[model samples]
Target chain A: MTDGLWVYLAASPLLWLAGTLVVWIAASSVAKFRPGNPFLNPIMLTIAAIAGILCATGIDYGTYFEGAQFIHFLLGPATVALGIPLYEKLSLVKSNLVPMLSALVVGCLAAVGSTVFLSELFGFAPAIVASLAPKSTTAAVAMAISSGLKGDPALTAAVVVFTGICGAVVVTPMMNAMRIKDFSARRTCVPWDWHRACLLRGSRRRIVFRNSYGTECNSNISCCTSVSVSQLDSEHLHVDAERRQAHKRDQGAGCRLSQWKSEPGKHRARTRLDAINGQQPRRRPYRRGPVD
Target chain B: MLNGLAILFTFQLAGEIVAYLLGGWVPGPVVGMAMIAVALTLTRSTSFLNPAHEGTVSTSKTILANLGILFVPAGVGIIQHLDLIRDRGFALLAVVVLSTVATLTLTVWTFILVKRLSGGYGND
Candidate 1:
């Protein structure tokens, strides 16, 4: 054979992913022994390990993405799952929806505008400037913008990662220094830009996820067409009103929605779970706490 | 832990279907998230108050526990692009900082203004 099967089976991306998994196991193992090691983070360790493997094997980037993309697919489901916590925090979102939305819009505009402006000022290339425009958003969305803006997707990914890491490292301290005790800065960004769960988790763990932008409040990452959960009781019908409205609306769906005290327009979800699978509706409760 | 993770997964898959039917203009993940929020909103408890199942990690917890893992790929991207950053590092740094600050400012402003105009999420 031409070793095609071996090459295909030995795809570089597989090595990268396998490397990633191995690094995680190793770091976690180290953590078990020495929980306080600073340089032992799986993040740093994994990257180094993979880079070393790719170097030793002479695997190019294109080959690595093939298998690595398998893990990338999880991004869709992971992002979607972030809403559960956001919904649980719907009240908090509602209590501060205006501030949140204001922050998101202004933040988006400012982030994009300033980068474009300053990059041009600094005499960066148009492609570089364009790529930088959407760096404030998450990676997937930013990648889309990069392609559209003719900027380097890889470069944009770099900016986004740096942005996230810096935000995580700095925001809390900055807030503390500024005495901005409002603590939660609700940013009504687009849906699908679901990065709020981390901040929520940080808040719950009292670890403070820094520089958080609650863009998911606006729509599906910022794509929320329905009202937030906290606003349900007040903006939603009172029990009697909801009960009556349910009767007036669908009579059936409304009744079901009302059973759980939900607002109609927002939660119009159709869970196409396999009815024939004999699987019961999930009843497990989360211990890590919902929505952080 | 695993059980909770499974619930979270179920929530996501189911939420995807629900969001699509609603004509979501955004990506599927956001819809799934909103769907999860809706489900939790309807339920009597949360991941915090009620433990999903012992020895079975909930989806909610799994995401959090694996949070750092999720970000590792991005970090790796950082390593790959170190050369680019070093070359035009100043401009890139400005972009990252300014964009982040700007987004944060706009988001907060809009949220507060909307709250004022909409009578605080238009509730009561």
Candidate 2:
């Protein structure tokens, strides 16, 4: 019975899935406990925990990967799924296309160029430089780019993961200290999802700093959402003003409608009320305080 | 959920075909993403293209939420290159950290300067 159980556990994908999920959940739980503490990042913690487990169990990476590949397959679909958010905020993206695109291009070049230059300065191999070239892009793209440049895909993957974790860990505090509050610039430079993932609240203007190893899709989505929200807010204000003016113009037409118009002032008041009542309740549990 | 997945996969497949026909210079998934975005713009009237739809949004969120997990297997493969890491670890670490911070600062400052030059805001 014991021998049979060991074989089943080793052969089945369940062990890997269960292990990954448990480590992730536990890491996230610890992250929640510490709140803004970057050292407790779920990704870093999960990686460390799993690496420890594999090392302890003496399981070769090949066997471990056979089961892990099941989870890895979802990455492709996830990359495609990024289209949802991108589509939703397409208009905002279109409006700021020039600035956003220029910034992205410059940022991408800086990230890749600096890595290659520094690697060469340190006398590293060309393969290592190639692997590092796409370190700031998403894992899938980075791997593909690495392969194209004749770099080791596995090395690129490791470097990409490390860059992401470092970005998540170090960037937030640095941003806070630097007092970088320009939302447009911030949106263009940093991945907003990192802020969302960090669970920080208030100011809504947190710095994201995605220049190191942020994925293109994520940075695009962040830029779109930031521009959209601000644009939508302005549009909403303009519409409200127009409605108020229309109400004043139509006051002579009908008494009943005028009675409705009497409450035009209340429209802004009600929306503010609705915004506070509707939006805050949903987000309050997730956000512990104004800063953290 | 199923529909969202199918749509994404279909675009990705089309991208793969295009990339292959074009000598595979560009990555298939990136091309697929661009195609999907273009399709979404061209077919904005279609209800299925609505990103806010519950199924589409939820499916996207669920998949992206755990993106880090998908990279684990590849990261673990680093064990095979322990020698490379050991030989060049310090340089690699310094470059990644310093260059990342430098890139972030440069990008952010450049964006602000560009935005200012375009007269988007009055006061810096």
Candidate 3:
């Protein structure tokens, strides 16, 4: 009787769609417990869990995709929605218009060119190279580009996630090593969403950074560097010390670090971070003090 | 929310149309993104007509905030390509990591150079 019921439900597209959403919600909640840990990525966890279930059940990917495609269809509208953040940051974009545009063009070339060149050097198949080419872009856009290039969209998505995690994990160490004193410049290294994934792990540090320097954080780039710096402090003491030394050279950041320690949460850093990421903060448990 | 979604879809539809005309070299949604940016810029003067108001921004934000999950379905296709991954996994990872680091470094340096040429320094 249970097998019969399972067969009936499995045939319906709603089953997997509903299952994916349920799993996602659960994973996201769990991820909140250890936001600083990169391995605790909600999407990664959800994908693994869903993939594991499918493998265990001996279900084909094609069958699971029938239901999951509903979620996939949303990528188009979401891509269009990206314009909102671009528009909101228009003023800042305008100020650094020349630099931003030039950097964007150069960055796009470097990302694709380096990927292709390196993939060729490694003697990867053409399809794999195409898939890797667009991995630096967000998954939605990258998958689209990959498919257009006659590459595997699935492989592209995996690569994109891998690329994002790599970028997130390396941003602090890299920026510190480069000695990029400009907070705004440092923030430009990683894409916004991936950086947010990295930064979200340490809410309390973000709150401290925000409360101590909220007004100055009016610009998105400013907030990102300070928040990430504060977040990475616990994970990398030596790097944190180097950053503090760099901050000491800048009067504002030097004092703010000291002030951040004593300052209680006057403003909601959650909301600020959300606003920066072009999303409102969801209602979740508020854990005060350091997350680490 | 509905209205905002309509606007987003309309832009995406337009993008799809454009991509079709361009022989699909560029993805439709990217074209749609560009269209939205252009429309936003053109309508900057008119607040009522502007799409960057609260509703659209909120809708987009909500969508983008959870954007990572949207790709899970596609990534699961990895099951079919397990052999490929098993063979090329290490090499693929090295390429991605090196390229990303290169991209970040190149982008940041270019940005700094341009910023310095245009002005003295960015606001700290």
Candidate 4:
């Protein structure tokens, strides 16, 4: 009777789908209390738990994917959804266009060139090296690029996730150790890089930034502003502290442009920062008139 | 929500067509992203009054907030490459780590250099 039940459940499409969701929820719940703990990453946990269960139960990845593909299909839509945040950051992007584009050119070349060069130095096969080439971008885009290059999309996706995790773990210490003082300089790559999500979550726990370059935006975190500074010098930290206080005062309405105007305290912070710079705050894309 | 989803899907479909016409040089979703971004920028003046715009932004936020989960299915594809992973896991890890470091350092350095040359502090 139990054996029959096992076979029946395994055959149902809902089984692994439900299983993946449950495992993910549990992993997220466990990781919730310890903010910034990369080791307890819910995605990593869910993938590991499900992969382990499948292995022990003798279910092949193909079988498991049949049910899980429903979730996977959302990646395409999520990619489209990235436009909203990209739109939101248009003003900032405009102001930083030169720096942004220059960084993109240098970053893309460094990301792909370094990966390919190092992979070859490590004696990886051409296909495998190609798979690793686009690991710095979003998993979906990287997978597509990998396929175009005649590499394995699966390998590319896996490497992308791995590279993201590694980037997340290393970025904070590496940046801090180098004493990167400018908040904007540190996140210049955020608009073009998804690897910073881990850095975002690990370091800036308050506001989640949604800016990216040419890939689907990761939305596992908050989506208000990507400009949250992490461990910056005292001056920027003071501005951030004021912003945080303003956010709290507004009952967590966040730093949305709409909210930024209504919250006098946030407005005051921005005005003060602008005064210090001896210039006016850059015009917001959504603002209707001159500063009040 | 449904209206917003429709808009997103429409853009994605358009993106697919664009990508196909371009011989897949760019991914469909990315092309779709650029299209929506352009649309949003074009409509920014009236975005405050457009309910559909609000709906799209909120809908996209909700989806992106759970983006990590969407990656699971593909990340699990590592199962298929277990042999390669097993054979060169350390080498692969080293390469990823080193390359990532190199990329981040170079990108940040370049941005700072350019920003300074442009006479801005990157304060914003």
lDDT of each: 0.49, 0.61, 0.68, 0.67
Ranking by lDDT: 3, 4, 2, 1
| Better candidate number, 2 or 4, judged by lDDT | 4
User: Alpha-carbon error at A40 in model 3, in Å?
Assistant: 1.2
Q: For model 1 chain B, where is the 10-residue window of minimal lDDT?
A: B48-57
For B1-124, candidate 2 gives per-residue lDDT tens digits of 9767777777788877987898876667766666666676676454775544456656766776566667766777787777876887888899889877866776767766676777756665
Tell me the tens digit of each residue's lDDT in model 1 across A160-217: 5566645544444443443332324331432222332223222112122221212233
**What is chain B's TM-score across the candidates, in the order shown?**
0.60, 0.84, 0.82, 0.88
Better of 2 and 4 by DockQ: 4
Rate residue A144 of model 2 by lDDT. 69
Model 2 stretches astray by more than 4 angstroms = A169-179, A192-292, B45-54, B122-124
Candidate 2 clashing pairs, residues 3+ apart or interchain: A136-A213
Q: What value of lDDT does candidate 2 attain over all alpha carbons?
A: 0.61
**Alpha-carbon deviation at A123 in model 4, angstroms:** 1.2
* Residue B68 miss distance in model 4 (angstroms): 0.3
The CA lDDT at B118 in model 3 is: 85
Task: Report the Cα lDDT for residue A175, model 3.
Answer: 73
Over 4 Å off in model 3, which ranges?
Answer: A204-292, B44-50, B120-124
Looking at model 3, residue A126 earns an lDDT score of 97
Q: Model 3: per-residue lDDT, tens digit, B3-104?
A: 678788888999899989989877787778767877887775535345766667667767776777788899888888788878988888889899988988
CA lDDT, candidate 1, residue B118: 67
TM-score of 3: 0.78
Q: Output the better candidate (1/2) by lDDT.
A: 2
| Model 1, runs deviating above 4 Å | A1-9, A12-14, A25-45, A144-153, A186-292, B1-25, B39-57, B73-83, B102-124
- The superposed Cα distance between candidate 4 and the true structure at residue A173, in angstroms, equals 2.1
